[model samples]
Target: MYVRSQSDDIYGDVWTEEKAYCVEVEVHRVQDAEDLLFSPWREVSWTEKKREELRENLTLYKPSFEALSKVRVLLLGPVGAGKSSFINSIRSVLYRRVSLLPIIGSVSEGFTKKLKCYDIRAEKGGQPTALTLCDAMGFGDSEGTGMTLHDTLAVIKGHVPEGHKFQSEASINFNTPGYRQSPAMEDTVHCAVFVLDACKVLSYSENLEKKLKKLHRMISDLGIPHVVLLTHVDQVCHAVQEDVQYVYTSRIVQERMQKAAELVGLPLSFVYPIKNYASEVSVNCNTDILLLSAVNQILQAIDDASEDYPSAPQEAETKR
Candidate 1:
């Protein structure tokens, strides 16, 4: 029997007949065991510098043609999917503080009743982002309760003006006030984002899915770019709920993204997982990174679409 010393390495010490038979051996491990409950945290290649670079890229984004000054992305989703909350999330990052604008909260029905366009401005009062986010009323479970197909088409064609209230009784017509008789590329939607709740993905209503499919077909016919924003990611995946950095490694999160792609008929790359500022009163870096990543992809798609504009050739030369 031997006395334990403070300088002794408990795991490295070997026992003999003369010493205490507390046989100990050091085991060198190359990697950790796989966690069945949660995925291990993996480092993302993008750093704060990369995020800032993307933000600067967006700030200086220019359309191939001079007719358009900004890329407009229209947000479409059912009530409670956090469309307004998503807008607030992005604004929070840009302002470097919590933003409660666009007035988002829980309710029996959608709170936004008008076609509102939001612009992002730098915290230090520099040039605003070249992207415009258009927020429309949430789609309802029943007919004549929320945004109608006619209203969506009007907006897609750049006919619906900012602040035009949606009338459940009927659709906007040619005689509607503030209607643009001849809408230009700048006034039209460059990309469409369908916001969905990751928690409700496995249990999405058939009616809502059908409506989304129909809208997808219409948007496809117009050759407009579209994507899906899978929100509430934190509520779905346990690992992500614990720490959002594990989002990319979690199998559950990957499955939800796959489901979103299947539902919207979009590629997996076009589906983004995001967590909005629903219950949080302050801004968070993890949340901001997710929102900005989605925004950056949408901006790239908008830029691609702008390059293929049929009228760009003549319009570009005419301007010169």
Candidate 2:
């Protein structure tokens, strides 16, 4: 039998007994595993000052061209992907309170049924910012379950109007009520955001995959810039759940973000991992920072896409 003790060679073997046997053992420090970090895969400032800076930037933002009044962003995704919740979160951050203007679903399906447009403000009763978030019915994984492709395309083309309830079995056309036969440049979507649950990125169904692929192609053909938001990121990594500041330092979260980017066929830079204000009663500095960062990137993308925005009917006629 041999005994172990603290020594200069903690990793050295212990020798004992008449047979002169040596048992090799290695010592490991607890701090070694605790100190393991991914070297901050992404850089983000988690301070109230940064949050206010982002808020000011968004408040002062405007469309690149004069024809457009506001940057219209369309939110699209599968059921329970937090599309509505994301809108509410943004409002909550901007208002510095818990805003639930958009209905969030509690079940496995989407809660938003109509094409609704939300005008955000930097403060309550303040002037509307130069941005609008349009929410639509989530895409389902089965036939005739969620928003139809035709309706989605029509919405992108600026044909559908606000408050138009989506019919999974029917597609929007010129004959539809309140259809904008000639939608202005400000009515169309400048950017398309595809929200996905970070935890379910790998388990997407075949039907959902096909629908996403088709939507991606269609949106690309329309020349509208698209991005993917991987929500519920706190649920994906324990480290991030404990402290959102560790989002970039957690390897698990980074891997999930990479997988989400791959699933949506977008570049790594085009994908953002966000934690919606779920179960939280008040605003959080870190959460607000992450959400604002995503919004800032989205607005930047919209400005980039605005360079190629289709000319308005009047502008086209005038130019000709």
Candidate 3:
């Protein structure tokens, strides 16, 4: 909330006798809906041409069959970590909001509110396989203790098998039989997109590192390369002289961040950061670009998903 005095509102006219010099600059109040999901408001002379041009080059993500069909990403995070919201953000990114309605009563909203997958091809669109970006139930260890960890894990696991490498003792359960899904309104989350709130309290919370490490180990063993989404970074990095790129100053924050990364184990590289809101316009953030800093990392994983396809691959003509 920035305040301006009445006098400051009016600009000084510098000896304007030739032409009437009246250039008005105003501040208008707008809501989160009006503002682009990942855009920061800035000042500019109102010109229709400029507006249209800006829209053309904008890298906005709107949910649409076109974009959705091209890739499949699974949203994974601790409970209340904004998994659903991020899924919505993806819809926004691909410009397919209208087409992406939560198929009413399809997934039993009261029991399991899942958006039906979009088959870009069926609608005279491109691909045959519909893209599935899953929003997995959060693994927050239950804000409620009455709920035992085992039952919660059962639901959270949601068809994602416990790979043989990690939980060797427990039988593998909760796997969506690889590809070729059933016709009965199925939503399979391929390739988990795990979220970590950048603003969450850092420092010692015993076993957090261990839990995160286990999660990472599981991800690696599952043979699914993942995208690490570190969100709400603006709240953590705003006040400091250090930029969002350097939010790891505090040793405590860094340690926790490291733990999150380590979870993915060796071979995987990099963590991505995003400022969740466009309340303020700054070079450090882009309100119109949900996690722009992390987009490259995400696309990399998406492109790599070809490796995980369940179908047998062509034997690259074995030359004698």
**Candidates sorted by TM-score, descending order?**
2, 1, 3
Clashing pairs for predicted structure model 2, backbone only:
none
Task: Please give, for residues 1-320, the per-residue lDDT of candidate 1 as tens digits.
Answer: 34453334545544333344345656786332232234333345446776676656666777655667777889998888888888888888777678767467678688888999988766646667778888999887655668887788789878889999998896888889999877777788888999988888888777777778888988877767899999988887666776677778877777888988887888888898898877677866777777788888898787776666565322333344
- lDDT score for candidate 2 against the true structure: 0.83
Q: lDDT of each model, Cα atoms only?
A: 0.77, 0.83, 0.40
Error of 2 at 309 (Å): 3.8
Q: Model 2, 115: alpha-carbon shift in Å?
A: 0.7
Output the number of the TM-score-best candidate.
Answer: 2
Q: Higher-TM-score candidate among 1 and 2?
A: 2
What does the lDDT read for residue 159 in candidate 1?
87
Q: Report the Cα lDDT for residue 238, model 3.
A: 34
Clashes of each: 0, 0, 21
Candidate rank order under lDDT: 2, 1, 3
Instruction: State, as a TM-score between 0 and 1, how close model 1 is to the true structure.
Output: 0.82
lDDT of 2 by residue, 70-90 (tens): 888999898889998998999
